[model samples]
Target: MAQKNETNSAKDQSNASVDQYLAKDPERLARNLARALEELGKAAAAWTEAREKGETGDVTTAPLIDMVRTFSRVSEYWLGDPTRALEAQTRLFAEFMGIWANAIRRMSEDAAADYAAPPAADKRFQDPEWGRNAFFSFLKQAYVVTSRWAADLVEGAEGLDETTRHKARFYVDQVSQALSPSNFLLTNPELFRETMASDGENLVRGMRMLAEDIAAGKGELKLRQSDASKFKVGENIAMTPGKVIARSRLVEVIQYKPVTKQVLKRPLLVVPPWINKFYILDLNPKRSFIRWAVEQGHTVFVISWVNPDERHGMLDWADYIEEGIRFALDAIEDATGERSVNAMGYCVGGTLLAASLALMAAEGDKRIASATLLTTQVDFTHAGDLKVFVDEEQIQALDKAMSGRGYLEANRMATAFNMLRAGDLIWPYVVNNYLRGRAPLPFDLLYWNSDSTRLGAANHSYYLRNCYLENNLSRGRAVLHGKPIRLEDVTIPIFNLATREDHIAPAKSVFMGSRFFGGPVEFVLAGSGHIAGVINAPDLGKYQYWTGAKPEGMLENWLPGAKENPGSWWPYWHAWIEKQDNRSVPARKLGGRRKTLGDAPGEYVRTRA
Candidate 1:
């Protein structure tokens, strides 16, 4: 009777504390809630307006349809046999039972209770309350157990083809991530505490921010990854000194100012992926690959691709090769008076450059001395989760969607990329920005990520069909400008750099692609993911890279024989570049014969999607 009375007294004290917090700012919270409602109405209006404007297309439903179809196949395999279905259910039920037992033990203050825990890397359940409080502890354990059970179901299913299995896993992951207890305000302990302390002002501010972001996206939620107002392109971000020496309908060739007295005779041309702006290479002086190359006495010329819109819908791969790559080559020759220049390409840009090299080889155009490919793939056999979205039905739907607008919307591509690591990229922001009502800290990388670019219908369609779907490039079946371009024909020395943790282009895929090239290939594996791995500066002395014999049978086989080297691969690559041609010439001014269009970043990058 005394213990019961003590428990009741404790409960009464907790209720009193909550009431005290609630009464602290009732009038303020009431006014804020009214404002929040008004903002929500505005957000709804913006969404409705966008729908009326036909901005959000049938593309959204296509994925849902594919997901359902894929899951149906998986379900058939399991549900067709009662035994298998029973086994799956039993497995999940057993896990839940164990979790319930553990929860009971924890509630009884049993220190020896073996509580189910989240992975150390999972940031969601970092709060002390998640482990200490019985309610949150149960919620966390239940979510973990359920998510793993779902994953196992997809993995254990039999007779499903590789693609179907892959889609099933991806879909399961998406659903699990979306349904995580951490995503809900009430279920999340930290968010719940903030709500109580602030008297719901956090939610009011969050709603206002949501409305502003929706309006900014012109209907879509822009999903602010960073405080974007903190940075600008030329003034702070892309501040590398350079001039747009030449311009075309598709690209602007920027020749960076020489920081050294003499530079390599072979002018270096950097072809960055058009999916995002070229400033990624020249993000800042400390992190800029272009600046580092210029400082190393190499005449750096970068291709600044236009953020395509309706007018660029008709431009295909052939047009990109002609107007973008070849045009830059011509401008490079005119500016430096150097016929033989070294070339580099990054991601999709690398793919395009490889194709162009094949075309150039066929036409007896030997302007390019050597080739450097950064985190690139000519083969897509192991292209990772991106393949989940690239089958026939989805592509057709995408084509229809793009045909209406003449381009794929910027946010569409951004959202797909974000989904690749939704736990890291999407939910954290959602919880922080919307639930916590805290603005994201200023991050240059996130800022660049948010500055997305639209994809031309013809170009994107061609890329998806040829590269991801057919795998034609490495197979020597890729046709360009009425000629079937073959990678084997291009005998130039190639430096292929693959990031170890790349989700976009798996290291194995890159290793396999090395076999397609005709020339001597130097395969280097860098640490970190696609972006951080490539942009790593030697001055910072971060991350490691590996160099080995020519990419042999498989990545697994190559790993044991490889020698690990410390720090950035920049110096090693520079050494290789010097070995190719050590001859140096007096540093030439910005432009020669080609007319200067504008400053380094140019007008094209300034045009936001």
Candidate 2:
């Protein structure tokens, strides 16, 4: 009897163990099983569709087939439990929705579907009302329905016991706001215009273009791959190994190979914005601004901001001035043995240079002979659409998100810039690339657009809050290295250059920097937007600008001093720079050059991400 009892007790213990195992992680097992079932269902459905429709194209069937097979394998692994299988099914269903979303985004509309000439009678193409109505009716409805379905789930997340839901909601809201329709429309008015640009007689041309996009199986505007192959740093420069200062965020300083004899009397220092790589000014021999300065008989040196690491989490606007600008200035002085140098700051870098000049003036360091600000803003009151993304609530939210990450990821920064010109930056590309299935040309600007750099969380937050959102820099409330700096205190000769159509730094807003400088100042309104205006070469025929009396406030005043000049802004700039030239003083030692390293330019910039 005792032996029989022992056997029965052991069996009972084994059964209990099995039950406990199932109880411990029922949800995970359930999810796995459901996912497997979903996969199998998809596979069967695909096979049936392929057989019925006989569709074998790469675009139509390959991706779907692969997905079906993948899900099938998943289902087979968890087929034993029905509950688990159902859970997998639900998860897979959600994934299916995502796939559909992507597919719908790429689908061409009726006009885009036909490559042939569109009928002249289709007034819809001319007025854009037809195209707009068709798109909004279908897409907007789908979006509304989709959101309505997800609304309960999003709200329900709040009622959940876990904190994950709350945090997830926060992130979702941030992303949603970043992609808000108002922001999108404001940034890409061009897209709205392009689609709506056609009049009754021109309707046929617009429809045909849309149709060609569909027939070619290309997206409206494909995003070309980035080419970081052109500009190199350390390899091109004849510097000792230690002399090169590289921030992954920035390329190395450019060393100009002297080709022309009539160089400037003073050594040149070029400052670029941290948002872009320095190569914008050094793209190619013909287009390179840095090269032009070098050929002008000037000893040119540029600053390459190092890419920020997570360790730089606490870096702020003042930190950049103290470390980045101050360090570069000291190095330039040491290398060339010059006590003072002509400083040209581009965009945000110009803003920092101005602030630093103020600080330097307070300390009585007049090392800056002349200060030139290119497409920079000192005051933000008139800053236009750039403001739409930086309101108090948004900045606070961004601060919270970056608070833990230490650095703002590059993708986030790229998204913000893209939002600034949605039509130009986003939609046409969406139509050509995603919908039409074509890639963009290998253009230099396109390549640069895809290359991005990260900013430390603290630095970015401080900039948005202080400089942009609050306009503190112009207000004289901005602090640098623990000291308050005033823009008006800058006594150096100031040259403020602005682009007439620059959305980033509107001409009027950039003009304010001169008024605030309280010193000898000259303002030049260049042709085109931010980048083109700065890159305008004197020989480039497609350019013009103006320089004269300032315009009054609150005027929609793009053409306040507009004129059709004959040449690019480059030669004009050279002339302006010549006027500021002092007597050619012998290059004195500032003390940092150890030895000549190797070549004219360097290879540090070639290092890829």
Candidate 3:
């Protein structure tokens, strides 16, 4: 576990920006500030030198000029929204004073313990010192108030793209996370107590963890928060009874052992995202979507994607279509002798599914009986904050980083996504792991998150360029199977599920993407983030979901017609899917007549990123 933590730490360093790591260190803060000044001085000197030399030729001043211009633009934006900026600032200042006054009064009244009831999800307040001492509690409250104010400012910033505003808010959250009193050595009261009790051994361990991360060149700024050893393929996590009926270089098609005497005649093939393990859908006996589908009297088959490395780096988006979806179809056909199957996809897999369906439609193929897209974006125009990292500069830097690496590392991608909600995701771990010197939480989701997969360079690059940067897929500009494929040509009935709190694939964006589908579509809005929204089972009875037949207009127009449903949308989905089917047949074994390629999870899932 220690070795894995160190390995992950190193991966995190490589994944995140150097400034992000450096900002965590107190001693380095001044040094970095000085360094920034020195760079500005050099830029100024260069400009002055060029001017004095009467050089008509262009100089390397664009970066400095752009920086100044950006500052001016931001200043203008704030000035334009003066009322918003002023109101937020005023509220922040008022809250800061209000917190201190309340803390003082409570302490005097011997009610300091009440500070534990924080106004926000502030972990610092959970510390004993914060609850016992007015000083520490005040500082914690002050920080929270200030952070909210800054975030509000960003949210109300004028003359910026929605994404740019989000980017600003991202930095504000990161800064708040970084400035937490709990992350530092001296400011953190728990660290001081640990220092005296353990004779500095605890401090040494914290330093070692940080050092391991730095040396490993991975930017895991937070504790992993999950023990990977506890979860294994076909044991604890993906325990659904199944057998790999077909295998290829990039995928394994698993036809699950049926639980009923009769099953839906049409097989359901799940195409999960290659960016992560397929086992997310088959997490455990209770949480496994695959197991539930089988229990629903449906023949379930899932595509277990390979964790790509340099060996598979040359594989592209088109390769995923041919080797991933097409092969899975062939395997299901070979097993059931069925000409058509209901296909489902999650996240990027859904995007790929849409692309493949478009190409198939163009070629007059009728293999898919129905399609289900879970939190996917076929149209990138409204792709949410993820687009901030999709531009030329970021993509070029990623290309250089992945040049000889063969594939995009897990931490690199994970770190970026985690940063979108740094306050919720990153800061709590900084307090828990580094400051408290605690072990990772036994969280199944965190375990799955840490157990990330590699994205093939050719494939990921193609996806980013074609889908994200170019928006070619929606425009019918993307070429697949030597033909121009468009999303509008995809006529299969589609069920679109989007999570309300999914910063990764925003619900509105998913709603917008569903409109491009040529098929009759149904868009459902579930409460939660990307993973939780889809993995939610009916038994859990958690999170509300709203349903609407896919609309011709935007999400705003669709809301009036939509109806709300409590608990998991899984049952609702099953009912909708049943309508798309024709007949029922006797349940089949894992391998009735054709030989089984391997076991449930198969070998491809075991391959590490």
What is the Cα-based TM-score of model 2? 0.61
* Stretches of model 3 off by over 4 angstroms after superposition: 1-121, 152-158, 211-223
RMSD of every prediction: 2.3, 21.3, 11.8
Candidate 2: C-alpha lDDT: 0.58
Q: Is candidate 1 or candidate 3 better by lDDT?
A: 1
Tens-place lDDT per residue, model 2, 1-609, is 999999899789767533432324446535544554454454355545544653222222332343344334434544546765565557546644654554455454333421121246622123333233334333333333343333334443322423233333333433433343323321232233332232111223323333443322222111333333542343332222223432222234543444554545566777788776666776555677776676566667777666666677887776776676666666666666666788899988887788888888888887788888899888887775566556555666666656665665555566556656664676555544432334455567666666566677877877787787788888888877777788888878888898888978988788765678867887788888999888876656767887665543422453544555765777777777788884554333222363434333344333322
lDDT of each residue in 1-609, candidate 1, tens digit only: 999999999899668645633436778767777877887888899888988987688687888999999999989988999999999899888988998877776666647444568887889989877876667888998898888988888898889899999999999999999999999977988888777678778888888888888887777888999998999999999899889998989998899999999899999999999999988888888999989999999999999999998889999999999999999999998998989989999999999999999999999999999999998899999889999999899999999999987999898898899999999899999999987888999999999999999999999999999999999988889888877889999899999999999988889888888999899999999999999999999999999999989887999999999999999999999999999999999999899776788888888998888
Best by lDDT: 1
Candidate 3 per-residue lDDT, tens place, 1-609, comes to 999999899678545422322334455545544544454454445545545654312212332343344445555776767785587667776887777678777845864444224554555556666655555666666766777766766666667766556556555556678887777766666665554444444544444454444323232232465755577766777888889898899998998999899999999999999988888998888888999999999899899898887889888888999999999898888899888899999999999999999988988889997999999998888787677567665666667656676677776677667777776777776655554556666777787777778778889988999888999888889988677898888887899999988988988889888778787988899989898899999999899899876556888888888898899999999999988875899998776677998788888888654
Best by TM-score: 1
Kindly report which residue stretches of model 2 are placed more than 4 angstroms away from their true locations once superposed. Answer: 1-254, 550-564, 585-592, 596-609
Give me the overall lDDT of model 1: 0.90
Candidate 1: Cα lDDT at 65: 96
